[model samples]
Structures are given as C-alpha cells and as structure tokens.
Target: MQVSGTFLAFAVLSLLTIGGAVFMISFTRVVHMVISLGVTFLSIAGLFVLLEAEFVAISQILVYSGAISILMLFGIMLTKHDAKDEGVSKANKGWLSILVVAVFFVIAFWGIQSTPWVAPPDNAAAVQEDNATQLGVEIFTRFVIPFELTSVLLLVALVGAIILAKKEEDNE
Candidate 1:
C-alpha cells in the first residue's frame, strides 16, 4: 500500500527500457537504432543493479552497452545496405507491425495477470550477497568451455567483419 524509492526507481528504469526499445524499433536509420539499443541495454543494466545483481549489471553495461553497440556500429559502417525498397510499402509495413505488437502485448498482459505472485524469502539478501561468487564458480567449473567458445566466436566475427571491410575497400 506504500510506494517505496526502490519501486519508483524500478518504474523509471522500466519505462526507460521500454521507451528505448520502442525507439529502436521505430527508428529508420541504423545508427539511431543502435543508439536506442544502447540506451535499452543501459536501462536493463540499471534494472539489474536495482535487483542487487551488481556483477551482472556491470557485465551488461560492458558487454551490451559498450562492446556490442560499438561492434554493431562498426559492422554497419563497414557493410553496404544501399539497396532500394522492393517490397511492401511503409504504410502496410507499419500497420502489420502494429498488429503484431498488439497481439504480443495482449498475450503478455494476460500471462502477467494470470500468474500468482509471491513474496521473496527473508534469506534472499543472504543469497544475493554470494551471487557473484556463485556465478563465477559456475562459469569456471561448469560453463567454462561454452564461455571460451563464445569469446572465440566473437573473435571470429570481428575478423570476418574486418575481412569484408577490406574487400570492400579493395573493390572501391
């Protein structure tokens, strides 16, 4: 029955996250969309911090807001997407997107309303305090191979992008 500062922070962060996503989807330019995506990523990081997951929040900022956004910008700058439109008109595309979004919203709203909410346990704070340690242990012990593989995959993608850009430069 009372409004807490944490709840207010959450409301603000959630609105920013949703607004950024909407802007990202609505933008026509690739650069604008990427910037909006960065904003969304940062807001989500804020939400994670609000939930007391500092390590995850920092990882989100560093990985998503910093590295991924920069990578996307580089990829966009390197690639040529100058092809003219040859498909549906903007008006039809807009209407179709609106319909799809409306359906998704309805489904999400129904799911949220139907779910039974429960309060957190008193020891949740104790569990959260060790989350970063637990996460590190799990990653190193159980998910180390997958984590290393993901890093390698990112390296490969970066190399591929550079090769493509070099090819484009050579052609030009």
Candidate 2:
C-alpha cells in the first residue's frame, strides 16, 4: 500500500487536535488553556477543510477559534480566579483524571466497535456537492428563528458577563 499526502495531512491535523486538547486540559493557567482550545478549534477546522467542507471550515474558524475564544478570554480577564491551595495533591488529581479518561476511552472504543457501519447512499456524492448552499438555505428557511435566538442568547451572555465584572469592580 502507498502512503497518500491526504492521509499524512489528516494524521498531522489529528495529532495537533489531540495535542491541543491535552495541553488545554493540562495547563494550569486559564489563558493558556483558552489558547490551547483555540489551537484545537483551528485543528478541527483544518480537518473540515480536508474533508472538502471549506465553508464549514471557515465558519468553524470564525465562530470557534475567533469569537468563542475571545469571549472566553474576556470572561477570564473579567473574573477573579484567585488560586486557593486545597487538600488534593496535583499528582493524585492527575492520576484520577487519567483513570477516568482511560475508562471513558475504553467505553467509547467499545461503542464504536460494536456499532454496525453503513455505507453511504448512491446520491451521497450529489448531496455533498452543494452541502454549504443547502445548509444555508435550510438554516434561513426552516431554522431562522432558532439561529437568531442563538445569537441573542450569546449577546445576553456577553452582557451578563460584563455586568458581573462591573459589579465585582464596584465591590472592590
């Protein structure tokens, strides 16, 4: 069997995505974690692009890597997260986390392996050609209210965060 460039690209992106997630979880600083999350988001967007979904990839980058990350950074900056030294040792917490992750991984692997995989339908290629256009049409026609409501909810959250931060500043 011959190795393909696409496979190599996918492997690199997958590693980056997993590495980012691991770093995000391992980092102690909130800002560092958020940056790692952005890396992970970008890697996911790369995966989307590799799958030929350029529009989805761009949206992923814009929404997750850009907006959501900035939102998280703003939230972190606005809040006071004073470190409180607790009873749990870092090593113990690390071991517990590892064990929990291992169990979850095992369960996920089992579930995926046990499931019956189905082949794509004959028209799958035809549908793939205009997925982005179809998605936009569906969202605007059928899901416009929900889409707009989501934007409203995000605005509300941003305002709430600002208000809470202001209240804290006043208290201080």
Candidate 3:
C-alpha cells in the first residue's frame, strides 16, 4: 500500500514538473516564468525524495530552486525594464513542433517497452559494486582538479555578469 502511494505521489509530481516547465516556456511574463521554474524545481526535488535520494533532493532544492532560480530572476530583472513586453512572441510552427515531438515520444516509448532488461550475474555484480565504490572514491580525490576548474569557470561567469551590470561612471 505504501509503495503504491509513493508511486502515485511520484507520478503526480512528475506531471507537475512537466506542466511547470511548459508553463515557464509558454508564459510571456518574466515573473510568471520564474515562478513556474520554481514549481518545476520543487517538483523535481520531490521526485528525488521519492527515489530515496534525500541528499540529492535537498541539494536540488538548495542549488536549483534557491540559488539558480534567484540568479535567473535577478538576471531577467537587470536585463529588462518591462517584463511583459519582452519575449512575448510564441513559435510560429508550434503545432508542427508539438506533433513531431509527440510522434518521437510514442516511437521512443514503444522501443523502450520492447526492450528486455537482464540482471547481472553474481561475478558481474561483485565487479560492479567494487567499480562503483572505486569510481566514487576517484571522483572525490583525483577528479578534484576538474571540479575546481568548474568552480573557477562559475566564478568567471559571475565576474562577467557583474561587469555587464555595472553602470558607466558618466551614467552614474
């Protein structure tokens, strides 16, 4: 019973997340788009919780919903004076795009449903567990170099944003 309830919850959240994403993309108003994005992030976090990844769920909420969404909202605010007037145009071929996407989804779903998934043998399972642990350890240690590089990239992006937002001395 509990498992079924969780599955239902996950399904509902997934639908909400997709709906929110669609709303975000379709809305003309920047504020409405931001709010829809927040809904999408929160729904995804709920999904992570349902998947038993508590740490990842919290991080998703903190990083995406809290920090990234706020950053995007701030960017929108700084870049545009009138929110409703900006990005008001919808795609001219939206119906065609939707039809193509639906056909692709149906084909992909049929292909996936036809697949046979097999569990690993005992020896393969042992190797898989060891490999997973080793991969995690390596990511935490040797891969720190790439991680630090990515942080530096983010810092550079922040600096660029500040430069762009700065008013000229004459304007000030």
**24-92 per-residue lDDT for model 2 (tens digits):** 867777788888999999999999989888899999999999999998877776675643223347878
lDDT of each: 0.87, 0.87, 0.83
Q: Write the per-residue lDDT of candidate 1 for residues 1-172, one digit (tens) a residue.
A: 9999999999999999999998876777778888899989999999999988899999999999999999888878767453222334687887898899899999999999999999888987777777789889989999999999999998998899778657464454
Tell me which of candidates 1 and 2 scores higher on TM-score.
Answer: 2
Candidate 2 displacement at residue 93 in angstroms = 5.2
Clashes of each: 0, 0, 0
- Please identify which of the two predictions, 1 or 3, would achieve the higher TM-score against the true structure: 1
Each prediction's TM-score versus the true structure: 0.76, 0.77, 0.70
Candidate 3: misplaced stretches above 4 Å? 1-3, 85-92, 119-138, 170-172
Q: State which candidate has the highest TM-score.
A: 2
**Candidate order, TM-score descending:** 2, 1, 3
* Model 1 error, position 68 (Å): 1.9
Cα error of candidate 3 at position 1, Å: 9.6
Which TM-score value belongs to model 1?
0.76
